[model samples]
Target chain A: MNLGGRHAVSTLNDIIEIPIDAEGDIVRARGTGRDICRTLGFAEINQVKVATAISELARNIHQYAGKGRITLKVLGAPRPGIEIVANDEGPGISDTKLVLSGTYRSRTGMGKGLLGARRLMDYFELVSAPGKGTHVTLRKFVR
Target chain B: MAAIANFEPAATRLARFAALRRALSQAESVDAIAEHTLAFVQTALGVRSAALYASTREDEDFALIASAGDADLPPSLDRTSPFIVELGASKGDLSKTRELGSMWGVDRAIPAWQGDNLVGVLFVTGELELEIVDELQFELERALTVSIVAMLREEELAVLAIQERELVGLLREVQERDALMRADLEKARDFQRQMLGAVPRVAGAEVAVTFEPLELVGGDLYAVAALDGLLRVFVADATGHGVRACLTTMFIKSEYEIVRSSAAAPSSLLAQLNDAIAKKYQSAEMLFSAVCADIDLATGATRLAFAGHPPACVVRAGAAAMIGGGGPLMGLRPRMRFELVELHLDTDDGLYLFTDGFVEARATSGEQFGDDRARDAIEAAHRAHADVGAALKSASEAFVGGAKASDDATVVSVRRVSPEEQAPPSLAPASAR
Candidate 1:
């Protein structure tokens, strides 16, 4: 079911929507991302990069948010690339800048989770508050 | 004139004998032959009562299959009984002991033999046994009695064959189901091994790990990370077993890696891990136990924390002592705080961390390998200058006495090497870059 608010976006033919609810769903969401990347003629290494990025995002929704939805789209106007959006209504991050800035308590953690996913995509956008939940949009172009 | 009278009776007897043979040869089942055979014996033999006994391969005795006219005979006769022996030893139809007839309450019992195997017996009371069968009108009836016994054996084999087929089908079905279950476990094991991280290499400290996974994939995991000047060892035991438990271990590994380098202390890292697991599967099945330790390689100063995990051993030269503060199980609630304790490890001193699987393992005699034994094993290993990891693993295995562990187990020990044992640094600054 579509939540259909500001988070909604028009997509082309290769749009696939999957709900991330459990731990197993993370693997499925990652697999679907890899398949679409391969179909679009992306290099093998870049395809792995995209799939690994999706794993971290899906893991957050499964671990922190408890439930969420992931939307995958093949972007045609964006130079034949892939666009993924992860939306969740669970407790959102209070501060997104510090995590992205990479000055986090980076000793024991893996670059604050979002910082790793952001590096894999050409375009990254994050919107959240303490209570408003989180929505992230990631895009990677063939070029 | 008397010879002509005898020829007339002999001709009549031959016609009667032919009729009896025709009737008995048509008996399809043993039950079908019972009434007809009894009627023939009672009337043609001039006997008051008659009974039939049949023996099958499964039976050790001839059982009274059918009886008519209430002949007083035993319900069954053992194969070795004197009554059956004497009857089997008879020439053809009647028991050899004609004078012993009243003892069996039967004048005669005609034995049916197929190649020396006693197949059946037909017993009759009244005047028939006392008369000589060759002189009597029913003399030719002996041949018909053998046909009834032959039919009984054939019917028994047919019943047994059908039962054997059904048993074979049931055995095959069970074997197929077992094969499927084994395949599932193997796949899960491969997945677990793939996601597991390697043990950490702490400088100046000798690190040894002991791990015991169950027959099926289990949730025990050891994740090590070398961060800055400390080696962070995260040992965890997730709840439950099987594929789901294996998946949870992977999830725990990923979460720990993400927060490990950023975490300020052992307690903070545990709190973050607890938050991640608790926030997910809110169900009780998601609970787990863990010990997080950050060892300072230079000073051998260790910061330790436990979340429902057993205490780690601080084994010095004299003896072993356990050190860890109280904490609740992870995944029960979010944002729960984990307490930490600080301990200093001198050179040659061993710091041992283990899951409950080590201390709670039971012997065949139902005795648990409690904390005291674990202390002794770790202490003895260090005092003997032995490999502490192998010592702990073998000690627990010997305690369980070759029984498969009921739960998964993991042990990690990092001891600061004494100055005499430490190797040279073996590295230069790469010609000053």
Candidate 2:
């Protein structure tokens, strides 16, 4: 997607390159998601849910990753959907199940946030290793 | 099998049933509902104790809203306690049980619901081998649900009331701020208007003044003061616009008026005004550029004092000359001295005093309509017309065409009149010319 002169591509074939430290990156990501969902003829409730999910994931990457990038593209698969891939080079997840179970301990008590995010989006995947890095991919279908 | 028949009074059971129904329906608040329902359950089902616990969505914390029967049980149980009951639990769910140490009792936890949404739980306990009254349990749950909904409704109302009060407070603050700003603006506009002196008609000179402020208040000022056989004309432009700039100009005007009365020389007036402004407005960092000229009406000679102000043009015999030497802006130094230059006026000569606003206006491309352009326009207007007012107005409009003015533009033109023009027509003989 091309957003305000900045390009963001989901895959190597359809890649969008945006400045790593661009201003209002979070707002731009969410706005682009909303605009794409609307243009793709998605329902209002589904659009809102997808936008909120993208915002939360993007914020997490920006805050924890120190510096990272995001890519978005329209996935032409079994269903018409939008896929968002956020990756960062930082201290990766130690336990994947605990993070997904919403039981991981933190200052905010790990309160059901991951579970809520899972519930909000249709397909959610998180791949992280302690030493390597973290990658999150989320997809929301129009149907 | 041998049959045994026993007779019991129908009135007793009827009276008990009527009392239970009355208690269930009369429950109003959450506590009242819980208390009445617990009492009914204890009486009808012969239970030892009953309690009601509510779960809040914000933190999933449970609080004991009502209790009945034995005081032996702990005053409260945490919302997370399995014995206290939770959503998706039934009476026969053994997996959700707590070890009760050889105490045989019928303990049932009923989930409280409001329109298919589970909101809380109700717990009832009875002695060992006690048969629970199914009809009584059903009635208790229904009554408790109604009461809890009422209490939640009241809570919602209270929250709405608080929000309404907060909104009203914010609205009042905005209104007060708006009113204060309006009054300040009115005051600023009044001060700007007072700073501008009325158009003066010299007995022997032709004069015209034009002042256009970009906003409700501006920083441009022009004053004409005639005292002690001297005609003092001044034009000042302060930095910026609106209330603060207008205030700076007002202070300058007041200080100049005060100094003009005591000082006969233009340089003395500038020095005194500069000292007063520098002392009074030092903290605000405000400064002004001004051109003050003292014209001797008797001798038709004017002494000019410039304080970083734009040069004034003197036009005589189809030639124009820039009058006065420039000095530092006022308010920079406490004891700054200014030099005065004198120019002799010829008949029909015009002195045009102005501010940078006339020359520094920007075109659409952000290019400045520089001083040279302004001078050309002035000369063109003069050649096209002889009226000084018309000429200046034409030149300003042509130079600032279709562009937003950046500051206030002011123009004051003074034309010297010949001696014969000043003399009364009846006293001058027709052959005198």
Which candidate number maximizes TM-score? 1
The TM-scores of all predictions, comma-separated, are 0.50, 0.48
Give i-RMS (Å) per prediction.
39.3, 13.4
Instruction: Provide the TM-score of chain A alone for each candidate, in the order shown.
Output: 0.86, 0.81
Best by lDDT: 1
Model 1: lDDT of residue A70: 87
Total clashing pairs in model 1: 16
lDDT of 2 at B176: 100
